[model samples]
Target: MPKMKSHSGTKKRFRRTGTGKLMRGKAFKSHILTKKSTKRKRGFRQETVISNADKRVVSTRLAGR
Candidate 1:
C-alpha cells in the first residue's frame, strides 16, 4: 500500500501537542486589523485549541501515529 501523505497546508498551520491536542492560530487576525479594537487584536494573538468537532479532521490531516 502507498503511504498516506499528510496535508501540507494543515501541517504548516496546525501543531500536535504532547498531550495530542491540536494547537492552531486564532481567526480574524490576519487582515483589517486597523478597524479592530486593541483588545480584540490582543485576544486574537493568543493561541487557540481546535474544537472537538474539528479535532478529528485535523488529526487525520496530521496523520499522527
Candidate 2:
C-alpha cells in the first residue's frame, strides 16, 4: 500500500500532545476584538483541548500522530 498522507489543513491547525490528546487554538480571538469583553478575549487567547468526539477524526487525518 502507498504511504498515508496527513490532512494538510488538520496538520496546520492541530497538534498531538505527548499523552496523545489533540491540542487546538480557541476560536473567536481572530477578529472583531473590540466588541468582545477583555476577559472573554483573553479566554479565547488560550490554547484549548479538542473535544473527544472530534479527536478521532483529527487523529485519523493526522495519520495517527
Best by lDDT: 1
Candidate 1: tens digits of C-alpha lDDT, residues 1-65: 67888989999999988997899998898899899999999999887898999988889888942
In model 1, the Cα lDDT at residue 61 comes to 81
* Candidate models: Cα lDDT each: 0.88, 0.86
The estimated TM-scores of all candidates read 0.87, 0.88
Q: What lDDT tens digits, residue by residue, belong to model 2 across residues 1-65? A: 76888889999999888997789998888888899999998798778899889977888999934
Clashes of each: 0, 0
| Model 1 spans > 4 angstroms off | none
Instruction: State in Å the error of residue 2, model 1.
Output: 1.4
* lDDT at 31, model 2: 83
C-alpha lDDT (0 to 100) for residue 49 of candidate 1: 91
Error of 2 at 20 (Å): 1.2
